[model samples]
Each structure stands twice: as C-alpha cells, then as structure tokens.
Target: MELKGFSTKCIHGGEEGKYEFDVIPPIHLSSTYQLKYEDQDFVYSRVDNPTRRVLEDKMSVLEKGVASLAFSSGIAAISTVVLSFVKPGEEVILSEDIYGGTKTLFMEILSKRGIKYKYVDTRYADRLEDEISDDTRLVMIESPSNPMMRITDIEKVSKIAHEHGLKVAVDNTFASPYLQNPIELGADITIHSATKYLGGHSDIIAGTATFKTMEDYELVKLHRTRLGGVLSPFDSYLLLRSIKTLEVRMERHCKNAMEIAEYLSNHPKVEDVLYPFLKSFPQYDLARSQMRLGGGMISFKLYTDDQDKVDVFLNSLSIMKKAVSLGGVETLIEQPATMTHRALPDEEKKRLGITPGLIRLSVGIENVEDLISDLENALRNI
Candidate 1:
C-alpha cells in the first residue's frame, strides 16, 4: 500500500487512529460537552469545536507547527494574532505589500490603542531592518504580496527579526502549505486565510494561525477564544474536505498561472507581469529557494491606465470572474485600484506600484489551452 503520502493524508489524517473504521471525520456540532471531570476540554464552541480542533491539528501537521487555531475569517485571525503579541505602546513591523484589510485594521483599530506599526519594503533585508525599533514586538510579512506579487525573503527576514528579539509571522495564504511552510524558515507563526487556498473552494470563509511554540499557541488560542471568531462546525467540515484536493488543485493553479503569466508578458497590451516563477521577476531566485511552486496568484500591469480600458478588459473576460477572493477551482480577476486595495491612499498605492493598470489574477485549475484562449479573447475585446 506504500503507507499513503501527504495527498492521502490530506484526505484522511488527524483522528484516523482515534476514529477507527471511519473513512471521514464526522462533524461534531455540539456547542457544549459533558464535563465528567474538572477542566473539561470541550466547554463551549466559542472556545473550541471538535471539527475545528481536527482542522487545526491537520494544519499543524501541514505547516510543521507545534499547534494551531482556526478562525471565522482571515481578518479575525490576523487581528487576534496582533492583539496577542502587540501592545498599545509596542510597535510591529510589516511590509507595505500586505493585504489592504490588514493595513486598514492596523490603522483604524490597533492604532487607536496606540500600537504603532511601520510598513517597509520587506523584499530587502536592509529596508526591513531600518523599520525595527526598541519597541518592536513583531515582524509581519506576506510573501508574493497581495495584488502586487512582490516576494519577500522569509528566511532572511525571520533571521533579522529573531536577532532583534522580535517574533516573526508570515501570511502564507498565497503560497499555501503545499507550496511553502514559513515556520520551517524560522517564522514563529504562519498565518493563512483558509477561506482561500486551504478551503480550495470558495464555499467557506475561514482562517488559521499555526505557531512554532506552545507559548505562542496558548497566547493566540486565548485571543481566538476571547475574540469569538471561531469557525462553525459545518464550515470546518467543508474546509477539511477541501484540503483533500488542495495539492492537486494548487498544482494545476501553478501551471496555469505560469503559462498565463508568460502569455501576458508577451502580450502587446501588457506592460509587465509579476509572477514569482517568471525569470523576469526581481525575486525569482528567492522564490525558488523557498517555495515548491509559485502557487496560483498573478499580478500584471496593462499598457494603458485608462479606467475604461481596465473595465472593458475585466468585463470581456468570460471565464474569470471579477471577484475579491482567491485560491479556488475557478479563476478570479480584480482591479486593485477599485477593488481590494481601494482603501489605500493614492500616494501609498503609487509608492507600492499598484497602478490603475494593475490586474491581479487568481488562475484556477482549468485547462491551460482554454484558459489562455479566454485571456486572448478578452484582450482582443479590450
């Protein structure tokens, strides 16, 4: 039988030994459990759920982490982690290329509590180092950054942060656990918007945080419980099912994205293509050193910045949907200026090179020839 591999484990891991003779985990929807003794493991759903616990355990194994906690939404996980590690007076270092929602959360909520945060171009270690201060508690980053495709050197960044006595957290959402594991590269914690890649389908909205140490786990778990952003048992079950096909789905995504990126790079209408696997990518070497595959996300700049042209191109796309989220079986396309990164200031967007012409694509596990033809048809219509 060859003892089955990761792919098989994705389908049947976590509790195989506990639930004998069962092919799949049964959803435990009970909100409370019988406290036969003191300090019961299952007191309330807010604190934990059986389905979520299994999901967390699987994530721990996937990310090679000591422990994990699941959340209702990606923002919920990020917010809880921030609150757990960062204090009002303390500072946290992050990259300028993070998700817009995360940036907004810091500016609006965390900032109100006096917690200062600095955003640096984390692609370079020197720039990231300059942002660190005596009050810095954490260094947060996203590799192949949101909507821009900027790749950060996690190992180098982690090393620098560790030397400074700062905890390191990487948003491993884009790459997913199949492509990259941040904790293995010295990150204290690896975060994911399981709503995206981990779910593998757009059916569920969930998030996860996997920690390298029990102390961090206990802290994040406490915050997760207190914040009350736990995922529902049903959603947890869906996520678990999705994980089974993640490897296959992600492989197709990577292949499709690479071919699409290459196609766009050569297109007369495209100004630039920003995919880590592309040789022209600035961080191509770094991406190779860390990730197994480039994953599904691709960001490209069009030759024209006119809003009308952008709208026309997006509208003409038949296969790709104009959506906000990523990492699904179906392709998603979006204009950062008016979509995901709209909350960002004009000046900041300009500095980050998130021009009006930029288009972020979440390539799906569709046939490559069909996908490319769809792009070609869309470009012609534009």
Candidate 2:
C-alpha cells in the first residue's frame, strides 16, 4: 500500500514499515555497516545511512521530486546544487531579496571559483528573461522571499527559463512543502532550510535538495558526497520525527500568521504589513495560485524610523524570542538591519526594502489571542 495524502505522507512517506518493523524508524548510529560482500546494502556513514535514507525518501515525496539529498546545512545544499552545474566563468540569476547568507555564498565563495551570479527582481517573471545570458546555468529564487514576503510566479519563471535552456531552483524554505511544492510548478530543483518548518523546532540545523530527474539527483549527490556535506544519522532521525507533524504544525503557523498580519495592518504603530494572504499585498493572487497556504512569515515596517524604537519593541516582547532563523513552534522576531542581513550594505538593504523600521516575524503555533496581546503590548510600548 502507498500513501497519497499529504498528512499520510508526513507519517509514512519513507521506508517506514519496510525495515525493522518498528512503528518509527530507529537511529542507525553505526558508522560502518557489516559488509561481507561488495554487494552489501550500506558500507560507510558518509556515503549513506539507514536513518538518512528514510529522510531523503520522505523529502522526495514532500517536495514532489524524483529524489532527494540531505545536507549538513541549508548553505551546503545550495552550494552543492549550484556548483553541480555552474562552472568557472558561468553565471546564474538569483533573487534580489534572497537571504543574506546566500548573497555571501555568491560573492565570497562562487566568485573565487570564477562562477558569477546576477541578482534580479524575480517577483516579476518577465524581467528574468532580460537578465539571462548564454553563460547562465541556473535561475534561483526564494518565493515569499526572505523576510520580504515577495511572491514569484514559479510556472511563468520556470517556463521562460526552460525556453532559454536554464534550470530553475527554488529555495522553498519560507513556504515549506506544506504550503508549496516547487517541483509541481515546474522548478527543476527545490531546496529547503529544514532547520525551519521541516524540523518544527530550533534544535536541528539541516538542509534538503529535491531534484526533478535522476540525472540531476545523481549529479548533486555526487557533489554533496565529494564535498562531504551529508547530514548526520542523529540529526536525520530528528528531521524524520519532525516531518510527521509538519501538516498539523503548518496549520497552526498559517492560522497564527494570518491573524497577526491582520492585527498589524490596522495597528497605529505599523506603517506597512507584508503577508501573502493579505489582500492588500500586491502579489496576493500570484501567491494563492502557487501556494496552498500563505505561510507563517510576516514583515512590516513600524510608523517610526528611529532605530532606538526597535530595541524598545524587541525588548518588550515577552513571548516572541529575538532570533535569526525562523519557522519554529515558538515565534521569532528579528530586525534584519542588525541581524541576518547586516552583512548587506545600507544602500542595498534599503533597495531591497529591508528598512530600518522593518521587523520580520516568524509566527509560531502559540495561542492566537496570546500572540496578539504580545504584539499589542510591544507596539504600544514602542
């Protein structure tokens, strides 16, 4: 029997009942599996592990990709995926509003290898064609883009890129597999910062890459293996356990976020609110067409421009933690100007709409009324 439902896949997607007959897969902690013959199933932990295999299989189903690879972190997955195709002198098009770590990878790492990239406004799919070059190998984007909540038309962008012989890879960290499956929308590869919603907790740090074809899968896997960026057996188990509750957790996350966005939109202290589900958002229709849910991320600017006011608001938030990464069960609030995107220059940050007054919130599964009160108290104090 096979599971077709999303929630069913969450519980039984991988090699669950096939091995050990345990209700949940056990941790395969052995670094070396017994291999009498050359035809043995598992040999070394780096090459593969029983626990990690289950995660890869499960991730494949969730992302609607032909195969999946688990990496040490989100950056490892992105680096391996990009390096798999992009060579010296070649270029790739990336989302202008992508997370800061990604921008660093392009400038600090890829540039040293002679691989180049251009940052573009991917929300407008039509603008993508104007940026592609003969040397371009990949079209990478982050829909509901990092902290900005920008939406990209996956089908439109993928179609245009395919015509130009470019592969499309979407960083689906913000939306998670519950809200969106990029592979289903024609993306060649879908990447995830599994440390976020996939883990559903702040305990694990991991990444995943799901490929549309076996060839792409094998290529990236080869890069991952050679680069030695595989996920550990223990962390793999944690990720698998987290996936089982992905559907239910996402339900609460989406619910809490919509209410929070609505609350902020009307607040006197909030100058602007950015949420895909909000009708006031420019890309609401595009987001609805590609994503099943609006996701838990929200970015808004406060009415005041004073940097000191940010500290007051952040310090007043008793329930929300001030942190960098997002999508955990506990709500996280951060000021990108001083935290995640601090590496970015002031002009560039301003151009990307990461304003001095902007606040990025990763809404969690806490009681909606409680969250509202928390935000209200903070806003009033600020």
Instruction: Provide the TM-score for each candidate, comma-separated.
Output: 0.97, 0.98
Q: What C-alpha lDDT do the candidate models reach, one value each?
A: 0.89, 0.92
Off by over 4 Å in 1: 1-4
Across 303-341, the per-residue lDDT of candidate 2 in tens digits comes to 987989989999999999999999899999999989999
Residues 1-382 of candidate 1 have per-residue lDDT tens digits of 3325667667756656657676777899999888798987788889988888889888887888999999999899999999999988999888888999999999888999999998998888777667788999999999979988888888889998988999999999999998988999989999999999899789898999999999999999988878789999999989998998888898899999999999999999899999999999988999999899988999999989999989999999888899999999999999999999999999999988888899999999988898889889888876
For each candidate, how many residue pairs have backbone atoms clashing (under 3 Å)? 0, 0
Give candidate 1's TM-score: 0.97
After TM-score superposition, the amount by which residue 285's alpha carbon in candidate 2 deviates from its true location, in angstroms, is 0.5
Pairs with backbone N, CA or C atoms under 3 Å apart (clashes), candidate 2: none
Q: List the residue pairs that clash in candidate 1.
A: none
Instruction: At residue 153, give the lDDT of candidate 1.
Output: 87
